[model samples]
Target: MTLTTVLLLGVAAVLVGFAKTAIGGVGSIAIAIFALVLPTKESTAAILLLLLIGDVVAVWHYRRDADLVMLRRLIPAVLPGLALGALFLAWVDDTTLRRCIGVLLLVLAAMQLLLRWRSPDTTRIGESRPAAIGTGVAAGFATMTANAAGPVMTLYLVAQGVEKRRFLGTAALFFFGVNLCKVPFSLGLGLFDGETLWRTLALAPLVLLGTWIGLHTARRLSQTRFDQAVLAATVVSALALVVR
Candidate 1:
């Protein structure tokens, strides 16, 4: 890798930690950074490792705060989506896949906005079973194909009325588990090579540092501000992916 790529990657690693520990959707910035610096396949693999590490720290910090039952309700529906995404990766063309994902995210963001506008109080909407399944499936597919599940998952959790700390805890465990599930396929496809592994190792310290910084920042943020920031970031990220 060139010096510029290395520096960008270090920045990306830090963003991963920050997203995991503090802001849920901000890690999508790391996804965009890696996609900018590396090939699609290599970028996904590198991100997987970094995300797994972040998950560990997040879960460790927020384990007591999450709603384990809600997380569990999401699993069965997610499995089919993951399998479909894996198949799509194996057979679909890259450009088409990107466009499809971009459209999906755009729709998700728009629908979320519409929902909030219709009901400023989101508690009833969050508890709907069908919405959970739909969001979980979409999140599974998005995460598997592009490591872009952050935006979708964030909307679901936020709409569900999860507070900041529980939100962090649930998201941490959720991504950690899904990323772990992705390992065998990533390895089987030869995405986890020595070079990427070394780079991930080299960038590990930045992830920790960023996580620390983000955690402090998150603690100081009001609940309302956190919600707005997450929604805005998700909208921006969806638009970027659509255009990229």
Candidate 2:
């Protein structure tokens, strides 16, 4: 890798580590960074691998607080998304894929704000079957397409009124599961090859370092502050993708 690529990956590593532990919603920035620096297919594979690293850290750190019921409900919905993502990825241009993810993030953010504003008290979005299916499908599709699943899941969890530590932990587990599950599909699509795998492996230590720092920071941030920071970062990165 060139110094520039290494530096960019370093920045992404730090943000990803922070997002996984502290905020639980910034991995997409890593996706954006890698996508910009590498081929789209390779970027997806590389980012997925890095994310899995982060996920392992998250699962280890938050294992005690996982919410199985929520994950159980969402998995069925997510399956179709995974299949669709794999199919689209085989044919879609990188530019189109990134833009689609950007638009989704923006829309999700707006919906989150609007829904909260309209009925701050209505946190669960009915907890009805329909809502669960919708959210799960959206989450799956978004995650598969861009590794941009954080915001959709974040908004859903926020609406579910998952507070603070449990919120972070649950998200950690959910994504850990999802990203791990994505590995085979990504590889099948030729996103991860011998060269990219070696490169990501070389960068593994940095991923660990970032996760450690982010996990520490996460424990320190107040719930309100963390949410705000995550939302803001998501907005900025999402906009960057849109404009790119």
Candidate 3:
């Protein structure tokens, strides 16, 4: 990798940690960064390791706060979605895959905004079985295809009106489990070569640093502001992917 690519990957690593610990959807920005600096398909795999590291920290910190019921509802649906996404990955070319990721992010962002506008109080949409299944499928596919499940899962959690800490906790555990599930698929697809593993190791420290910063920042933000920041980051990152 060139010096510039290394620098960009470092930045993305920190963003991954911050997103895991603080605002979940902000990691979409890191996804766009990785896609820009690395090969499109390879970028998804490269970032997954960093995200898994961040997940471990986030899960440990918020272990007691996760909503186990919601996780149970979502996991079964996610399996089919993962299978579909794996097939999609095998069929699509790099440019098409990149554009699909951009479109997916934009659609997820729009759905969140529309839901919030329709019910300012934010109904417990996640309680609906169909809603949970849809979110789970979308999340699985997005994560498998682009490492962009952050926004999809965020929208679902926000619709359910989960408070900030529980939101972080639930999201942390969700991604941790889902990401672990993705590893075998990624490996089967030949996404994790020696070079990617080495790069992940080199950038691991920055992820820890970002997690620390995010822990402090999360404590200070109001629930409303936290949700807003996540949505804004998702939109901005989606636009970046589409236009790039």
Per-model CA lDDT versus the true structure? 0.83, 0.80, 0.90
- Candidate closer to the true structure by lDDT (higher is better), 1 or 2: 1
Please give the range of 10 consecutive residues that has the lowest summed lDDT in model 2.
121-130
Pick by TM-score: 2 or 3, better one? 3
Error (Å) of candidate 2 at residue 170 is 0.9
The reply for model 2, stretches above 4 Å from the true place, is: none
* Candidate 1: tens digits of C-alpha lDDT, residues 1-244: 7989889998989999999989877888788788778776678788998988888898898889878898887877777778777887777766666667767877877887888888877767777888888878888888878788888889888887688888888888888888888888778777788988898789889999888988899899998999988888777766666677
In the order shown, the candidates' Cα RMSDs to the true structure are: 1.3, 1.5, 1.1
**How many backbone collisions does model 3 have?**
0
User: What lDDT is obtained when candidate 1 is compared to the true structure?
Assistant: 0.83
In candidate 2, what are the lDDT values of residues 91-190, reduced to their tens digit?
8988899898899889888887788789986456736677778777877777777888888887777777777778878889989888888878877776
Give the Å error, residue 119, model 3. Answer: 2.0
Weakest ten-residue segment in model 3 by summed lDDT: 118-127
Best by lDDT: 3
Model 2 Cα shift for residue 176 (angstroms): 1.5
**Which candidate ranks first by TM-score, i.e. highest?**
3
